[model samples]
Target: MTETWPARFIAAERYRRHRYAANHPLAIPRVSLTLDLIHSYAALSAEEYLVSRRASEDELAWFHTAEYIEAMQAAERAGKVSRASRQRHNIGNLENPYFHDFFTTPATATGGSIQAAEQVLAGYLAFSPAGGMHHALPDQARGFCFFNDPVLAIMRLRREGWRVLYLDIDAHHGDGVELAFRDDEQVLTFSLHMDTAYAYPFIGGGWRDWGVLGNALNVPLPKATRDGEYRWIFGQLWPRVLRAFQPDAVVLQAGTDILLPDPLGKFAISTGFFLELVEEVLHSAPRHPHGVPRLAVLGGGGYHPLTLARCWTGVWGLLSGRRLDEALPEAGRRVLQAVGWDEDEDEDYYPVLFERRVEAAGDGPPREAIRRLAGDLLEQHPLWRGMT
Candidate 1:
């Protein structure tokens, strides 16, 4: 057999065994659920299996302070929290509560992301479903994220001489990532998220938060934007960035919450459109914000279990270059049912959502929404000043 792109999957059954309590946003058995989906449906070859290993202390130190890791370790030892620890790092809190594997489980996910980036750098299209913890900050974590994996990966790639283009499609703003490289010119961050006032991580994502690189780009759309508007803004930002910096690698966080039924997000995008979006990324092979074209696609944040699985399964299949049959395969459906996810038979899984979706403001996109946003953004970026 021809040696295909060296694919890898970073997961451990142990990670699923040690999980958050049920009903919490982070409780779903992500790697396990995704594993079951692939086992039943995907034509995954042996090479794609890249089980996760915890990122080493030095790796964590790349993007996190020792004190932060110290705080996490201390929180782990006590099991039950004490007042002193609480005051130091806010260990046990409403949002980022202590979970079963609070200390190390997230590390596996972070490690997996780092591994994925390594494979991509080695010249293969790589993905780590456990990655995209974009909410974790260097000093602390919020929103069930303990460490920012993608940030760590970008920092790692930078040390190796690759200019990185960070793309986040999570419904919530990628505040942690944006903050980490906010001042560094080597990294260019692009985010399209639901407006902060209406979503979690509610403090940022303003287009004006342009990082020190003056390369940060934000498209804060109103709720209910569908394929057209979503594509428009992305269309605008991606082209200009490619023209300017021409990145060597692009890290995309494909969080599924933007789908219609996701509790955490308000947008009603379907999975089909997402496949096309990635397709475009490969087709254009943007001007290297880095030295070569590569990708590290990841699962950022999605609360709905089955929906998340369905959305990402498409991503995996797309990367493999196989067309999905519109009808869900029986074996795949059986796999989903094993996890108590019933099929929404009426739904279509390709090209467009079963329903004809619209943009935000309850009206479809205006003729110039894409041009206006892209035009406005380009006017301020350094890439436009001859970087490309």
Candidate 2:
């Protein structure tokens, strides 16, 4: 958490095809709001920026199926689709309805994520709030994501011989990441998402889907999970994961979707709790892997504009090792208002969503739940197992 660690963030000046329609939560003021807030905080250098562009066919060919990419681009450019594109790629599907230049936004997110992995390899703590599209497949887009940035990034890192510990705190399971690395031993992906029974992406993220070499870990929480419930299971699960993976580094998908007001989730976790989880991960996870630098990607499931920025700001603050300001600065507010204003739906948006209350259990999870779940995991394995 040093300024020396280089808190890199990625965003673009190119106009992203921002929304599908009015009132869709994904259509709200998000990534740009985050960029505005970070700029206001003055944590990043204006000169040291990284923005992603529409990925070339060559780059897309690396991870995605070429036919799918061709159809996607063709449909996007024409601003209409033929039956073949729709039938084959599910582009016309309700969740990810085709839009102009569809490849541009997700491609930016994808390229930025790949760049983040490369930067982390070069010893910088780079982040792309645009990445973490955990739903896209090699052949088709799923959820709202047309390109799976996290999966592509992990694939790139694994190709470089890095033993990766991929951790996600998004309310939705990183289904695509799990499937992409489902059988790979070089990468260990652990997701703590809302259980499939009552959540989006209702297919995977269960514990039983563990990988071929035992490299996957999925712990699903029921709806409305409080701070105690989430931290409880994660506390038990993470130690075992890091212990067994013995990673060279860690990648965290710190999606704000776990927040209660998040349009996609029912979890009631707070911003402070989110910040604490980050603190613990940055401090604890690396030790087992010999103190490798960890890179984080902003993941899914946030719609409340204010909540999204505030939650992400905590991550920025923690990485900067700075105190969280009690109030949102006007500059941050202006940026949020700008995104929301252009969308022209919610005019009265502010960055701090929750009513500003800290949990009684201090920064960690409830002592009782932690003691109960972690006791069993600890009893099964010694601390040094994680380090080795």
Candidate 3:
């Protein structure tokens, strides 16, 4: 078994055992599929895989209210929710849903995130594919998330005196994480998501919503955005901002919903570009402000099961320093083929595990909108103003 990589993968069988409510966007297994693909491809040794634990109520208390946590636990135990509990805690609704392990599953993912944070702090890298439930609020469930694991992990990092940069590439804005550290200067929350004007959590990721002292910068992209535009915008501003923030640690919500054909996403980004984006982030880790070479990666949102499996398995490849094969081996292909999705309804033949290279869309509203957003951030945010 190869053992040269300085990273660990957090996962367990429980992630596959518990699933979201039927017909929900998250009902498909995400982490488990990633694990299976990587294992099938022989990407990591047994020593590199860490079984995730469940976050205790105390750990959850760092961000969530005790009453809210108790209510969720009660709902899970009883396998149902009272009308008042549902109304108050936002559980039992179609968006949040009621199911056994509703609390336990998220708690386990939170535990994995917290553990990954600790690993990063210790000068090692870790990827928790089940973490990054970014839209959950302290007291309520929102946007298919019941627990905000990224917020919990970031809050824990803050307590250790580490400056954190919360970056999200999800289709939806990271409203909950931004709100958690909106006023604090220690954490800089930067998200590039679809404009919330017509998307879920329709309140954040706007240029006008910069946090205290320019701590939060939201670059809202237009629908059907292409890879080149994203590359252009990110290349123009993000490197300068990262240098300015000089974060002690970076917690990236690496959501793959931006890939084309995602049921919930509007962007036209390909999986290859998504992998490249993560590669850039990893490459910048050593130059962090605090001289801390630590990074914690978490999975956020990807409704397409095959895409999630491919993208996140690629994430594990990058973190583990394993070279990925362009074409998946037969074993890995079998793993992805086993996943049931609406996409599979058509006639067969998905030969590759990674997305094929493609060109960016031509000029339009999406490009113009991204340019404006980038210009606003570069011109207005304190981090970019000095650079300008």
Candidate 4:
């Protein structure tokens, strides 16, 4: 409803119907819930809601291989991956399983991401709630992502002549996206994720593993990292990186799995902290040499349906210049209540719109460890120097 913000919500109803099969971590509704909740709160109007378009094979080929794309399409049509396909592409593995509409579903999300990129290049803020499948490879599926939508989106933006500042705030490292642009100077990647000992894609993102071109900074936070710790490190590093990179556009992989209740993640952040980072990125964009820097926001890896709905809905609100209220509206409450989960442990306490205050876990690694993490990263002098 607010015209001043100049934002659009890129989503599709097909996300509700074509989802991961039962028993999968991604089986629960995400984008649909966020869309419904945003509608319920009157945060997005009909004019602002754009139906997602499906990515064509040609568009998909911008990132994925033609043979892999054909294999995925074949698997989708047959409702299964062939033995060879499974072995080569990791398609039927437990992490990335064969499911109905696998190709088209991810293609739709990819298309939305591309559209969001176009909108950002045109000087509009675009949030694609279904994008950010950051773990998929160009030829293989990994960590439940069939297509690396964020990579494709960023690659498209780069082709249009924008120096990209990629910030990933997922609990799990964005290995796929990081690997995609590791050697490219046009895109500077910074990821703040959980330590690999407890997270998925349990490789890379350490302090020492700067990308081939040293354009990447991977700050691996220890387990149970709370808001204070996240805020401290992000504040220390991001401004310097932004000032150094001076990107023409910013793309954020906003994955809320770091929220406390998420079953798949280990961090203890709140929805508020997540929004704070997003707001910071949005505000910094205007300072770029390119007048009115563009931003493309993508949803990444949140597992809990309630957290996904609240965090992303809050993101949509912030993108549109609305702030969070302690108490949610009645319609919003109904939307949260309708969310069905496999477990019924905390139904009474689930619908709160704001993250509950949580003390930093003293049992995890000490603050000095985090300081050392940053120090070691700074010791990679050339990477830091390039930005300066």
lDDT of each: 0.73, 0.69, 0.81, 0.81
TM-score of 4: 0.92
What order do candidates take by lDDT, descending? 3, 4, 1, 2
Q: How would you encode candidate 2's per-residue C-alpha lDDT over 159-240 as one tens digit per residue?
A: 7888888888888888888788867778877788887867877776355566566566766666667887676777766776
Clash pairs (backbone) in predicted model 2: 243-386, 257-301
**Candidate 2 C-alpha error for residue 386, in Å:** 11
Q: Residue by residue across 9-69, what tens digits does model 1's lDDT show?
A: 6566766586675656777656677677676666577777777888998999998889888
Per-residue lDDT of model 3, residues 1-388, tens digit only: 1432488898879877877767888888788888888888898888888898888899898889998999988887888888998889888988888876767888999999998888887767889988989999889998878889999888888889988998999988998998888778899988888988888888764777887677887888888888788888889867887788888778999988888757799998877788889988887764334443578999999998887787888888888889787577788767866774545355222333333322235333335667777777777777766653
TM-score of each prediction: 0.88, 0.85, 0.92, 0.92
In angstroms, give how far residue 361 of model 4 lies from its true place: 6.5
Model 2 lowest lDDT segment of ten: 343-352
Write the residue-wise lDDT of candidate 4 on 216-335 in tens digits: 788888988888888888878888887877887888999889987788999988777777788888777743234443788999998988777888988988787776564566777677
- Stretch of 10 with least lDDT, candidate 1: 350-359
As a whole number from 0 to 100, the lDDT of residue 90 in candidate 1 is 60
